[model samples]
Target chain A: MTERGYAMPMRSQDTGRGAAVRSFLSKSPPAAGRSRLPKVLTGIEGFDLITMGGLPAGRPTLVCGGPGCGKTLFAMTCLVNGASQYGEPGVFMTFEENAEEVAANVASLGFDIAGLVAAKKLAVDYVRVERSEIEESGDYDLEGLFVRLDYAIKSIGAKRVVLDTLEALFSGLGNTAILRAELRRLFAWLKVRGVTAIITGERGDGALTRHGLEEYVSDCVILLDVVAHEQVVTRRLRVVKYRGSAHGTNEYPFLIDDQGISVLPITSAGLGHEIDEGIVSSGVPGLDAMLGHNGFYRGSSVLFSGGAGTGKTTFAGIFADAAARRGERCLYFAFEESPQQIVRNLRSTGIDLQPHIDAGLLRFEASRPSTYGYEMHLARMNRDIDAFDPEVVVVDPLSAFRGTPTEIHNTLMRMVDLLKARGVTALFTRLISTQELHSGTDQGISSLIDIWIVLTDLEIAGERTRGVHLVKARGMNHSSQVRQYQLWDGGIRVIAGAFSGHRKPSAAPVLIASGKPAAKPKKSAKKSRR
Target chain B: MNQSLDNDGAKPAGTAAHPRTHYNLRLYVAGQTAKSMAAIANLKALCEQHLVDQYSIEVIDLRENPQLAAGDQILAVPTLVRHLPPPLKRIIGDLSDSEKVLVGLDIRERAPS
Candidate 1:
């Protein structure tokens, strides 16, 4: 299998196609003898992977969705990408919005439709079909539309075409029989022209398209859906049917941002990440010693879960600071507080992150979880990671996100998988309620985590002391003893002994180098081990 | 016949007194098909019956000039567009029903004698 991983011939050899192909082909069994259809890659992120290659070549694909579900944007992205990235000129025939409206709508996405038009790489023809303006008298055919489309295609030598919402014709023309026959002919005509076309339709009540366009364009059907859960809107794409190819049947979450549409095919990453043998420190030397392996495995994911104010952020900040101290790039994603707040709060605990940030070794991204949906957050994070290429990533307090348990778990799992695949170490902090801490429910992402640390605020003899417990560390004989730790202006000091009982006084601390003991040791333990 | 003569007499006097409303019509067709020919003939007959010498028809074949179809936003073949009217109107199909075409173009018809 390892040999086959490298020996497999890649179906898409286009430059800048990115990891979608590599990750997809890594898990799928090789096609032995079956012939695969030729495809035109739509340069949208992760869309190609779900379709295996792309929309079937020289076939019309039906894209049906409800209002504001990004059906038109999806079609326009394909057309623009085909023209710009793939060097294939395209024609956009809009039956609803005019040419200027169509161009203006996608302008924010940075699609230079006007420039492409000026360069003769794209042609946009708006077909206005107003029922009020049109009066039907006798027999007529839709040959004029064909002529216009042909002219546009011939003028640019287009290989891609888009008819955005062909259902508008059904309302314009009352003769359903003639309209249906003409549409069937138009689809067949498009196929014969050898242009990969996208025909968008309004979603029907029960069917795929309002006008039943799925009946004519049977080659491929893609459904775009927008669902709102807890007032957070998420757009999803599903390959409803693909005639000649196997496609992902899952409803992959997609995002429409400034750069355009990007679908996150999270499950396609599978569990085939390469493991690293090296270990990274847990920031606090005492915590690293507690893990027995001296640290977490490189490229592994660590979860720090505890109730609110259990010093979860402090632990994450220390790990990030440690990573930056070693001259490694670290990205700190702060969800609960601002970057300045985190830096100032950590500064009070003797962790100065300003220097690392100034030295460009550390970067901070702070955004409230409600600013976007879960999928958008993932998409933005994916973009940031790609741009920064950090070695260590810190997502402080994943619990700030408001979603169902499964949503949070799935997002974290994907994030971990993404980091692992890139060989980047990730640390996530989650806030667990008091009940959940005793119940042992840690957001259900523990299986994906390589190391789990539970922080607790223990009241020992009327003294509220912080305790650090290593719940599980994969492939390591970690200490199971819950050790008490104290936070001081100097730094965190993991006292050199287990909390044997609630009444026991503090044990002596083995101070870190270049550190002073902020508190006097109540009693010295002779069993102190480094 | 008497009502038509009365309207024609009134039209010539109105034409002499002020500028006549010359009907400017354009018939869009593709490849001179049977429907296209029928539409052209029906449009000419309607113009002869309604406006005699006060109308002019320009037939544009999309097969010869497909680019022109986009200028007028034409999608269906055998379409008649009234260009000279204050409010432009479009009627698609072969123009078989003169009554619907007259109503669509807002043309006032003379009552039968």
Candidate 2:
């Protein structure tokens, strides 16, 4: 008999009543001092993180979702990832769609189903059952299905199996009583066989699965939902239950593009990543002087709050260029302007961003926030950041988030948390309201930020002149002076004399004492070995 | 008896004048299980009584040819399918109830009248 609730010592991470309830729901009763349960990595992005490794090893996981929710695709990707990445052979037995159709559907994903089959690493079987062809005149069990599945698994020595949409058996056989009992036995048999399995079921109203298969497969349960808000549809996955594991219980927004399924757990990141005390350039020597230090700490998030025409994006562009000039990578996420537009506009400030981009050191990701849902933008940003692995990230003008203060703060916090966890310095520019320059309502990230620089247009002597002030620079002594500044073609530099009652003509580029690049920080020689 | 003989002469005897009607039946089973064998025997007895020499029974075992199950839409075993005698019919289950089987195959009219 299969061991029920195989108790393992709970890890320190598995504390909390919610986790206990989840373990109980997943049917794994916590024994006082058991060891960690082994996990089978699905290799799907963000999925393994939320699953605390992957689905419980050698156990069945029921993936239930509504129509068009990409359940089959999720299962297929898991199988493929297992076979290709984890070196575990898988068997895909689909009851709803034929093997050929499934193969064709996932062809765009670049999954070589046929090649895997030919290599004996994967097997795809379409269990076809029809209601019209056969008449039942006697009591029967589903032994034929078991036989076929056994043959398929043994043919390839499969370690993973997927039964996609097994509800078709009910419609085909028209005998729920017998099928339900047999299904229970099948799940048990699968456990006995010791192959990690995924069983997809259609979501039912008021039930986890249409056929209540959730009752039988209780090791782990994942619910996939495609929710529509306004006109945008976002796919989300939540781990309803996970036995013998401490899983993230949040409804993570998932994306189904050419890539199969990527669950983006917003809370997957923690604030426990090691902190670095090393300071990096603010890109502007004057700003560095204002901070009374070399620059903001590496891995610390810097916020630049300014109104329109205060040159917020320009500041970010300069910072990005400076990082790139230091032979480090920087990523610029412009929500308001396209890459070319931002590049062209920043040229007015004499900031050469094109060369860094051309050199592949600076990458610009520009998109209108209105084009995608908030979570999609976050997911895409995370994906790009993961791929780019930049040392510095700049999000120009956080105001484009276009949400309530709390919502915007939450998003910014998550993004900053993610960046900080990766040990990457982040610079965010926000547009401050003109009425109140230092109001927290206008700039909610003041608490989460390590440095806050506010730019304003001070109307003095009947002329509008730009002013830059360091509002809050944590852990550093800085000048409290509201230094006057100018943004012109040459570059941006502070004008020392403020409120002098005399305004001079725009001066030529006064490059800060052209000293050799600040001595490089001491780090491991193999640092940044990608 | 004399009166019935005079009437039969006038009708030229029912069996001699009427052509034998054909009853084409097919039984689908997964394998040679006890229930499948019983269904076959039960169907044969019913056909002998009702269809006389006018019926032919075809038995299909799905175990040897599983792919054919999809072609015939076979989901359950021991299913009897009536193909001929116009208007096809089907009866599922063990076919233990001869009265229900006869009615399902539309052979009730062939009963002794």
Candidate 3:
């Protein structure tokens, strides 16, 4: 018997495409004579949103992760939440910990486990796999387990299923061979009966699932990891594989709290937001004059594309502070630094988000984009936008949204549409490659927006100079010449093009150490080399 | 809560005591094939062997006063109620299983409780 766990070959390598076709067919509405099929939501926040109405109705998905990274907790939370939140009853089968202990452990997390069970919204059966309990008797099958599950499901007519760490079947059962075969049969049985299932596995090094059941069941596979680097402990999720849909490969940071997990995406922070028409300064009077009679549309998207360290974030901080000074709300989602670090950096540029934070006018959200799936990141931003409700939404650099084009396009398009509809003046600073700018083509976003500002760093004859120029302003006439912009204590100062040495600066350089000349990002360099 | 029986105390009731006295039970109905007709026939068959009242029967046609079926548990057209003893035992169904109806209502052969 082949011991490969979850050994289903990738669809790309499948023989007749029969299974995919059949799976697709099965997903359509059942025959007209059939009654409605029940699908229970998986309680993980935003999970339902991404799967676009939750895991495909009744199919089983494997949530695999290393121990202590909250593997079982993830599965348990789904069952507990399903019953409590959605009124969809569920049954949890544990092959690892005993029932009482599992319940107690989760109780600390504030999940009303006992109440749920007493209400009969949930059923927990711990399959005892202890060493001395069973005799390795005759051709025994998992018929008993299935029978118990069937009875429990019928008792309350449960619609959700969770099998926690089925690894115990390796030892508790009479034979591994029978268990494996039965496992496949069990998934088939669940499909026929239509119960949305979540089966968990311990994280394994090289396989999709622990103990190798990865290929057998599960339409999706998610991984959770606790990354402790430099004393920062963060829990992040990466959609290792979502078989049927497009998912983000990046691991996104998430917070586990009394209300469960909340994933944060900073760029999506100010979306779905409404902005006040109230006037605020851009910290630059001349540029403001060149922009409309006021400064940049009150709630329009402003992009400042410049080469490295050209004060992109610094300029945004000043605008953010300007809004704060006027008592207008501003939310700065710094993808690269913590709010404190941002405040410290901003103070040097002459604006502070802290006092406003104290006054409750300005807020900051920061996270590495690599920590979560793209959609999750975007969804988290939408959530934050609702909570913050900022009039001025500033994303330090929009280039991060640029790395993954399809998602970036979708995410940005939705974001732009939302910002415009809400009338929240939005600011996005993008670092364009020198090549993209010099070649006389707008960086991708030029077509998607109403205003574009080209910020440049002129490094000539050894001196580094910076300039900001407005290329286009939608529905408004704006500055058309290259001008000098400086980050001073408390704000940015803008003047006609600098009167210093000129290197004829191009796009921004990728952040590098030593503050020495930063190397162009390899991707950009490759394009230039080509 | 009695230790001797599960809830509802499964007990046999309405058995015949006098061998000479036949319980003379009549299950009134319009005719056979109707639910009431079946109930009447089923009751008579059930009592024949089990009850000391190896009863006789009479059929009453109530398709005219269907109103009377409601007073009884006659939601269905056919219903069988043991009318011999003071209290009645009702069973609904075609006279499919004679023994089940008798056992269910505890129509026992004459035996003291």
Best by TM-score: 1
lDDT of 1 by residue, B1-113 (tens): 11244433346323321146777889999986899989998988767666667778999999999999999889999888889865778999999976667667766442455
Ordered by DockQ, highest first, the candidates read 1, 2, 3
Q: Candidate 3, residues A408-472: lDDT per residue as tens digits?
A: 76666666755665467888877777787897545466776767878787766676667777789
Two-chain DockQ for each candidate model: 0.79, 0.22, 0.01
Q: Top model by lDDT, which number?
A: 1
Docking quality class, candidate 2: incorrect
User: What are the lDDT figures for the candidates, one per model?
Assistant: 0.80, 0.74, 0.59
How many clashes does each candidate structure show, in the order listed? 0, 12, 29
RMSD of each: 7.5, 10.2, 18.7
- Model 2: CA > 4 A from native: A1-35, A129-134, A436-439, A461-463, A496-530, B1-113
TM-scores for all candidates: the values are 0.86, 0.79, 0.52
Give the DockQ (C-alpha) for candidate 2: 0.22
In Å, residue A321's CA in model 3 sits off its true spot by: 3.7
Interface Cα root-mean-square deviation for all models: 0.5, 4.3, 21.1
Share of the reference A-B contacts seen in candidate 2: 0.24
Residue A49 of model 3 has an lDDT of: 32
Model 3 interface CAPRI class: incorrect
Could you tell me the lDDT of residue A270 within candidate 2? Answer: 74
